[model samples]
Target chain A: MTTTPTPSRPPVPGPPQDTSPTFVGMPTFHRAARAALDDTQQRRNLHHATRTIRDKRSRAVAELPHWEELRRAGAAAKDEALDHLADYLIRLEERLTAGGATVHWARDAAEANRIVLDIVRAKEAEEVVKVKSMVTQEIELNEALEAAGVNAWETDLAELIVQLGHDRPSHILVPAIHRNRREIRDIFQREMAAVGRPAPKDLTDEPSRLAEAARLHLREKFLRARVGVSGANFAIADTGSLVVVESEGNGRMCLTLPETLISVVGIEKVLPSWDDLGALLQLLPRSSTGERMNPYTTIWSGVHEGDGPQEVHVVLLDNGRTHVLGDRLGRQALRCIRCSACLNVCPVYERTGGHAYGSVYPGPIGAVLNPQLRGTESDIDRSLPWASSLCGACYDACPVGIDIPELLVELRSRVAGDRGRTAESVAMAATTWLFSDPRRLTAAQRATGVAGRLVGDRTIRSVPGLGAWTNARDLPNPPPESFRTWWARERGGGTREGSGR
Target chain B: MLEPRDDVVPSEPRTSGQRVALFATCFNDTLWPETPKATVHLLERLGVSVDFPADQTCCGQMLTNSGYGSSALPLVRRFVDVFGGYDAVVAPSGSCVGSVRVQHRRIAEESDDDSLADRVAELGPRVYELSEFLVDVLGVEDVGASFPHRVTYHPTCHSLRMLRVDDRPLRLLRAVRGIDLVELPEAQECCGFGGTFALKNADISISMGSDKARHVVGTGAEVLVAGDNSCLAHIGGILGRWRTGIRPMHLAEILAATEGTPA
Candidate 1:
């Protein structure tokens, strides 16, 4: 019997090549932000959306007299979880297995996608309905599934809008924050049918009508799908439960309707205990959608014989998290609850919108988090650190109290270190050298004053490299003599005349 | 020896017997020497002894914020050495003072120099931005200065967020005789003068500055006043380029004004 030479068991698909957009080739923040600034409609849409949310968030937060206490507890809880992340994760896996769910660990995005793909392919499912999952977006699971001929349907209203428009998410909580109601109507009319059920031809630009169209369009997909994909807001280690907070019922539909359920969660999402949910739940709703309590709070632990998804799978994703945790100062970014409060209040984000950040994550948190998670390896990631004006607004608005400005500064040092020696570095070194000795600084100031004369006026309307400054403002004509010079001659008893005044 | 500029006339006689050292920041010392001079005049007028340590240079904020924390170490050491002898060190610019108070220790710690960190910690509280000194330390809101102009105050982000000198400049401005202190729309927003932020991300910086200039002009104010000249230089540069008929003035210059010397 010629035994068919057993083919080398197809080399277990080594971590499905990470297909997630790393924003690898995107232009620097300055270039991208410039383009974003010129888009007046996007600016207007962002301004309205952010301002509305900012006001609502303020009111929601103010309703709780103990909001600050809640923030402290929430922050402390995350810090504890992060400190003992390995222990908590192990406990979570054990509890999940005990509760009848299959647990898989993915070292990176590629691994995570491969695990999910293997599960779906095993079930012989052609399509999967999805809840709004930032982690899924981070891993680009839908893109992977599509490449493998499995369709992933986004059921959340905003996520559906983004999916239908074939666009990327901008804001963390509201993925379509850059699109106004009219824009949504146009997107629905143009793109809804290509994917699934079409929007009513009579649909107006009114928000309710647009939402209704999305609801009808997504409902068909949610009921027929035998597979569901989700991301958890929090994963409880003690009980092996996953919690999802949402305003709409789409998360509920997707979480319950499918026979085979798969959840791709960040390892950082695991809480040490179920009790930690109270503080996070309270903090998240107010900070994110500006609701005192989310309309839908779904909690599920593995499966029951007759309820929910009978075959449940949990894909624990690492995907750059371990590297982020390695940074002592930067690890604080892990405490983030994906609340877009920082985005709403950030002036930079308000103007440039989320697209400028060039990541699934955007705004102040993205500025720090992306660089750490992705490693300042690309132009976009390197430029993310300088995207802010060191505004502390984000820090104040953060529910978990991440010192975003401090992290931005810290990450900037890393980015600078990677570049070795640029003109800015050389100039900084020279300036520091001049500043090390007061006499040298004084001499430099004298030189600058002499140079000021070459311009012939006390104001310079233009200068090379400082065109950003001179483009809109004028540089003060450098004083003929520096303060030290005036101080030495006049105040310090040196025999020299004050030149100008 | 050269004397104090003829443009500066002491508004009030010195008598309070509080000794203070002037930490004239690098930006003020180089581009706007008049700001520190005004700070000295205002402090001395309130009966405080003001000393200028010749060894003092930059506060190292520019270096630290620009991602050269190590390069800022020598300057941080120089700062502590030059001003550590005094009971209190006052700088005119809120941005510089904010850096000295907030970033100096972090810069030292990041470099793993525990001694420098300790020095920064001990000395940080003693260093005050000008308005902070006038209100928190000296316990004087009104310096009996006179500036008859419709002026609006742009609270620099460092001073507003870092120093928390809210309403101190206003209280001082409110007390100034003949000063029309109008409120600036969105006064707390940054003027986009984030040290090198302007040079590096000039387009965004200009966009932010233009908004500030529009608001300043909308208020019909003759002058835009702020505690930090760095912010003023940015906003003022925009206003100057646009010729909005409004000029940016340092808070110290406004506070130093007297009936005899109109700012």
Candidate 2:
């Protein structure tokens, strides 16, 4: 079995795609997801990668008997923090400021970008090395930084592939899960510098060689960078500390090696205290990387004394998170620990892959979280809630117990409430009208049975208001006799003993 | 309206007096008629006198899940009217039962029927899935039912996730007489027959169903039992296609098992 080295994956050559970050006016999920789904290579790459992660996660999770309890605590803690978020933010700001770290609050993506760009410019740094940050990906921060004339180099291996390849992250943990070894080999051969070593002179798809190539390429940038930017795994409000957990130690280098450290974090990533932080630390690594402990767990509190970074700045980003928190049923989505367990176990995510989600977050959690955070007005966002088969695997896999399927249905209802012409809602209303009274249901069944014979083949090739439904499957033409009709016929077509209620 | 203290059973058990109405779901009323009978049998065996209100019809779960709150209102009203007086209402099908217990209030509140909403909220917790009633209300894990089949249980999504009745079915299954319950891998995952979702998105639905089918086959059991027939039908169809040795049955069918009778 080809255990393709994770970091050795070839770099995607171009800069990131120029499509705007907002999923506004994009095609429906059926269209967008299908476009991605049609690519057999992407599907295979995703299937193999997700399956590997899921297997490792199950084993890692199984090792802890109290995983469920730990998850519950983590979820509860996050919920509590969200409920009193303003207070925690005040506390965190006070603590961080006291510790000599300047905290900036950004209400949305534009503000956050402005803050980071201003900080990088003020530092007068020509370039900055970044640890892979999903929030930055969410806001398209690298592009923003580049547009502002500051070059940001991605330090995470998978992130480096995505940035260099000019591709969107396909999976949360392994952003480059959509590209295989041979594809990586091709990309590196095409993209890497010919003046310096020229990609190992026909580099085979061997994992080690690829990893060595990435290590060599990234090592130069890491040592040369004067400023570093990153996203935090968690922020402890009580200690005014930030944590970054990763399988690779590269994040540690980005956090500590640079003279100035700038971390962009979502406001919802806060925990009230260290005990709360401890609960999540146990829950996150196992659920995310399927590891007992992440290879590197870095925690930095403000400006350390002659250690790590002398100048530290933490930008707490809101960006619709406050709005998400205001929704009672929808608010639970903020509790996500970014374990990607939900994505790994999700069948829809398994098939369509993460890029189709049109956001940094994907899978069941993304289906609910993205639409709420971004507002479900756009076609892609509206289509997301319907992306799932409502299988609830993500809920099962979620260490925080997000109840994702319920939220998906809830969001779908909100979307339908917006459109006001879903046909599903109409059919359901008609069915309910019939079911409320048995007489009507039976009459309707008989009427449909008559219609069923008129169709003859008992298969409808087409129907109005439901084009997608007929794409691959057919309705059973109301079944020759309804179960009610069969019951009556079996009882000699006579009014059975309790037939007329 | 009524005395709040008199309506709900307190945390402490009051075994001397309790009442319940059996809203035999449409599927259980006609297609799987024995499910209601089994539910009644199990409840009576546990010293609870259950009333099968013949006027009860479908709970409009099909309508509500399909997003028809307006049409489902009358069904909710009828349900609240028919089974209103009983201390508790129980049903064999989790999805149907879950609809009544969970969605009924949502539908009523959306329709602006405040009184109906109040009634639904009161009746909600009282409406339990059969295993939930057996375990929580009747306070007995062992219902004294005998099923000798080598069976594996598929915990339907509505029953497990929506209702949060995780251990009820498993607890009862473990206590059954002469039953060998093989643990199903990924038992919490959905079987993919999400009401009309199976018909609407059959390709993706079948993909999910097939995955569930494979997991069922992996259990090496002779039978698969679940609370919802909608899910069972989907899994059964896939099993039929594969010509797998296992068949899908309902928990009620398993619990209704008699001596020397094959389940």
Q: List the residue pairs that clash in candidate 2.
A: A8-A210, A8-A211, A12-A164, A12-A165, A13-A165
lDDT per residue, candidate 1, A312-414, as tens digits?
Answer: 9999988888777766787779998998899999988888999899889999999998888777778888899999888588988899989998888888887
Candidate 2 residue lDDT tens string, B3-78:
1232222334443366677777775554455556666565555566666654567887666555444666788899
lDDT score for residue B28 of model 1: 89
What is model 1's DockQ versus the real complex?
A: 0.47
Model 2 chain A: weakest 10-residue lDDT segment is: A9-18
Candidate 2: interface RMSD in Å? 4.9
Separate DockQ for every predicted complex:
0.47, 0.17
The best candidate by lDDT is 1
Q: What is the DockQ of candidate 2?
A: 0.17
Please state how well chain A of candidate 1 matches the true chain A, as a TM-score.
0.92
lDDT of 1: 0.85
